[model samples]
Target chain A: MREILRLIVVLSLICGISAGALTVARLNLASRIEKQSDFYVRGPALERLFGKPAEELLGNKISLPIGDHLYPIFYLTEGSEITELAVEAPGPGGYGGDIIVMIGLDLRENRMVGMEIIQHSETPGVGSRVEKASFRKQWQGLPVDEPVELTSQGGQIDAISGATYSSKAVVNGTNHIIDLIRRHRDDIMAVIKAKGE
Target chain B: MTLKQALVHGLWEDLPPFRLVLGLCPALAVTSSAENGLGMGLAATFVLVFSNMFISVLRKVIPDKVRIGSFIVVIATLVVLVEMIMKAYFFPLSQQLGIFIPLIVVNCIILGRAEAFASRNPVLLSMADGLSVGIGFTISLAVLGSIREILGAGTWFGWQVFGASFEPFEFMVKAPGAFICLGIILGLMNAYSRMRGETFIQT
Candidate 1:
């Protein structure tokens, strides 16, 4: 009986101490970690879209709650007049797993300005080729209202000759970005208007 | 054992993944490049040294049966601390290392040292053991990473080491290449030990 008591007491004490230490460490590092992730991961992916380092884009980002994910919405501006929007979403049905796609949308033109694969685990040299400029270029200036699909699905985008799965994944990811934008258009615009002034 | 003995022990004797025959997962997975290997080794080193110290300190208080549980708690905390620190400061490397960083909690080096060495030894000696083993592991990873990076990409640490005519054997950077590289290193180390008439691998 005493042995059982000792075990429980000792285990809980250690766990409690561990929980305290981790809580303190997490609290201190959480914000800094978020910033660093943005700088290293999102910043590089969004470079072409911003035409500048994503460092300046930090001030314009707002956290938007959608479903279970809180996404950082970056509102791009030209001299304080909001010109475009940028976001990242998990595009499912990927060849390997969920492919995270970052998208930039031109509001005035109602077209996709840029798309970049932020993260993926697809087969290298094959599905990985979806990240190539030749493939990514197909998404640029694409109308957001239309359903983005592969040529086989009676749409315009051509799937890579041997990488049909990955090609389809990117098309779905592009459409996912458009779906989010259209669904949240009012809330996003309201926030933009409030921030613009 | 003397501090010098402990320090040198891990450096060459129990040299980890190679000689200690432990922690093969990270050694094989994250070591595609020198930078990644060095980063992972350092992160493990930090956890190892600190966990050894803490376990040694608490050895008396923790009961024998529940010791593994207590050790795991301590090790998990340290790993999370490492993950947080890496994400905050070494974001790019952390990103590159990805899931492996958190998996450091399961690394046997920390647990093995705690159970075998730290639990039976004093704090200072345990720390020394941890440091030496950590350093040795780091060096092994760096060497392996360098070899793979150089041959696989025709570059070392992202710097081109060969002329434009050099076409890299991309196979060296893939999964099969990892097994081959690790196997060759282990084989060579064994051969060297045999030549010296000494048993290099402790486990």
Candidate 2:
């Protein structure tokens, strides 16, 4: 009986120590993320640039609903007669996993300004090349109307040498966003105008 | 029983992945790149060392009935702590590892060592066991990662190793290649052991 009690006590002590340590670690992680977000503007800088307060530009705390996906839209009023909408899209499964891409679109010009890979788990030397500036720069100013094709298909953009699948995934994801933007042009424009009013 | 025996055992006799086949999930998942393999190896080593020490200290007092459950809870807490720290300081590595970071809670090697060695040993001995096993696992992962990275991408540590004319094998970087490469390596290990007059258990 004494042995049993001793065991119980020891187990409880270990559990208690672990719980306390985890609580402190979790708090530290949260604070670090908050600090990093502050440096990156937390998706509000683009909104504030359009002459509207951050909160107003982002709308309600809940993101605006788009077909099947909730997209956070930021309104910018640079008075260049062009409305740019940033969209986050998920690429089909790559060698690593689905790649998350952030795309910038110029609605008036019907072209892409830039595309950035937010996250990917692709192999370091192979699939990671998809995130290289040289690879991504190929998509800049690509017209929305034209099909995005790989160099293998005789298109202008060159695919990463060993990451054909991942490169295709990114191209497909970007094309999907372009199609969505074209379909919702009127509603997107309305949101932009609503911010101005 | 001796420190030399403990160190040597980990390299072959009790290898975490090959002999025991523990921690196979992370062994397969995060070994896509040499960098990722290095990161995971170090993280797992940290968990293994601390968990073994704590488990050894409490082994005498812990009841056998619920020992496994108790060990899991302790290990899970350590895994979460590691995940949190990695995310805070090594953001890129944390992102690269993704779900596998949290999944370390379920890795079998740490639990296996706790049950097989630590539970019956003194704290100091357990620490040594942990260190040896961790080193063995790290070496295995680095070897596998180097092979995959070099052949699949024609690069070594992100530098071009092969001439410009060398076309990398596209299939090698895929999930299928992970299995094939692991199988080949295991066969080679077995063959080498046999040639050295060592008995290889087909586990």
DockQ of all predictions against the true structure, Cα-based: 0.63, 0.29
> Which candidate number would show the highest TM-score if scored against the true structure?
1
| Span of 10 residues, lowest total lDDT, candidate 2 chain A | A42-51
State the fnat of candidate 2 relative to the true structure. Answer: 0.51
Candidate 2 lDDT over A1-197, as tens digits, reads 98778767877887888899888878768878544433344344334223345554444222356768765554444674436666666777588778777676776787777777766777767898897888887877889766687789887778888799899878877876777677876777666566556
Per residue, candidate 1 scores C-alpha lDDT tens digits across B1-203 of: 89889989987678898888899999988889999999999999999999999999999999999899899999999999998999899888987887788789999887999999999999999999999999999999999899999999998988999999999999988878889999999889888888888854542
Give per-model TM-scores: 0.82, 0.63
DockQ category of candidate 2: acceptable
Worst 10 residues of 1 chain A by lDDT: A50-59
Number of backbone collisions per candidate: 0, 2
- The DockQ leader among the candidates is 1
TM-score of 1: 0.82
Interface RMSD, per-candidate values to 1 decimal:
1.6, 3.4
